[model samples]
Target: MAAGMLAGQVALVTGTGGGLGQAIALALANAGARAAITEMPDRLPLAEQTAAQMRAAGGEALALPLDVTDLTTIQAAVDGAAEAFGGRIDVLVNNAGINVRQPAFDVTEDAWDSVLAVNLKGLFFTAQRVGRRMRDQRPAGGCIINVASIMGLIGYRDRAAYCASKGGVVNLSRALAFEWAAHDIRVNALCPTFVRTPLTAPLLDDPVAGGDILRRTPLGRLATPEDVAAAALYLASPGARMVTGQALTVDGGWLAV
Candidate 1:
């Protein structure tokens, strides 16, 4: 409810080239935070475009190249963002993720590995690096929001690898929250249902599959990037200062049944 609540905050959001990541970055900027937008090397330009949009709308922003699976690159980007943004990172939105949909029996080893590498493994290390910085640097501890999914909380067909990876994220958030409590670094997750994004386009394009999804959801609609962004903004704000180790479900009543 408090607008401009993050006026003096610095937020680092991963995978900000497009989709939910870009939306979150823009939302953070809109809410009065300097944003560091990080993405894969190939997507650096897209990240820059997001940054440009942020700047155009009267926000401070920086675009950096990152490979979430690579520790060295993650560390460098973290350090770079801190240096560029006055030696502190108050918020981290772990939004970088990937999915390879396949039935359990049909899933290939490479597909599983790649999905976990990005969604689970990459998320953990990125948080580790930023968590350490926040624990040691910020006098006022920071908040971390992991962009998980409703798939993480409940099973779905043809999403074995994706579900498994997000399930790890769901629990990892709790573990990190407990461990980091003493350090004042709060950790939480944003579990959204089927959102209208590139990631869900394939499944949503299938008339039968998409219709089934909507029929099952009580709200009967897909989530928007802005919907997820608003939730992320709340998690990053002072309003949620006491909220941690929880998965704030942004589903359209999909899991209610």
Candidate 2:
């Protein structure tokens, strides 16, 4: 891919304190887009670190406090990003999500609510807010990349709520894409298999669970943040202009079986 494919574009990525979100933010910046790296209030410092890295690499970036679960914060972050980027937000990356691993029979209301709240509800509201900005901007239209998971396509143990939330994201992307097509907005979901991140370290480090995952995957390896970031860059680039309402999987053939 050519460098600076996204020159002058502006992007807002949620939950970008570290891991996949951080990777996506960096990739966008490297592609010549001004990045708005957002995280929870307490995690803002980490986001600042990411912004600093972008600057060191000769990219523009800024850190913002965003708690997706809170509607106020979502609106604030969106407004701040647009204001900072000359009243335009070309890309929205809904990467903020949480998972609660529990058996169906043992799942509690709180656990289910929390997972859905962040993964689905927060994603929806954030997209809605960003979509509004995208629609009203001078050259109305933007790309939305929702970071889903392979679990959305295939069921897995101890991920009931996660599966449901990601499933919702897949369908929601379709619905939004169709609705926003007239406005030039494109919506898509990015689904990746188990990725090597701090959040998944515990599971990936467990011999029993990790071995089972690798055995099931045709590639026999967990995805890296860069793997998923590349897909996101494609979705946001001009190359994917005709692509929308699709769930692009970076699962290393995990779903082929």
Candidate 3:
């Protein structure tokens, strides 16, 4: 693999306390980018641990606290990252999101709002802030990767809120890509099927839900964090210079059926 694909670049990835977010951050760092690993204040230690691992592997990394629900801190986080890395962030990975697994009717107003707030609203504002930074910076060219899900493309039984939020993310990526193309900023979405992460462990452990997921995926397997990380690396690298306003599905052929 080409380790220098992202050499000298700076990347900020949110929700990096564990799972896919941490995997993406580590992948970026391994690809020779200075990675900023961030998460909620309470999860800052996890981010730091990931950063430490990156550093141990001879990569540059920074750990920061970020809560996507708080709009006021978005700018600060982005600005701080840029300042820490010579005034530019080449990649923005909007990976901080949440889900509420409830049937449409059973979902309370609070559940709906919370899911949308982090998954949709937070993602938009974070990209907006980062897009502005990319636009204003000299030699402007940047990438934005939104971590959506296959649920956005299709539907699930008890994931009404999650499905709605992710579906919005899919379209939002397109809108941002269209509007930001002139600035040389590429915005894309990554849609992955069920992965065996802490976040999805509960769902994947259930006999019915897990069986359904496996049945739908032609490959009869779940995605690994590395699977999603590889796709993210491609989208962020120059190899995908022409790719934007697209959702790269990392499912194990779950959408094929």
Best by lDDT: 2
lDDT tens string, model 2, 143-251?
A: 9999999888989888899999999999999999999999899999999999988778888899999999999888888899999999999999999999999999998
Please state the error at residue 233 of candidate 3 in Å. Answer: 0.4
Task: Note the residue pairs that clash in candidate 1.
Answer: none
The local distance difference test score of each candidate is 0.93, 0.94, 0.92
Model 3 Cα lDDT, one tens digit per residue, 199-228: 888988899989988988898899999999
Cα-based TM-score, every candidate: 0.98, 0.99, 0.98
The ten-residue window of minimal lDDT in model 3 covers 96-105
Could you give candidate 1's per-residue lDDT for residues 1-257 as a string of tens digits? 46588998999999999999999999999999999999999989999999999999989999999999899999999999999999999999999999888889899999999999999999999999999999899495899999999989999999999999999999999999999999999999999988878888999999999999999889889999999999999999888989999999998888888
Model 2: runs farther than 4 Å from truth?
none
**Backbone collision tally, model 3:** 0
Q: Please give the lDDT score at residue 17 for candidate 2.
A: 89
Ranking by lDDT: 2, 1, 3
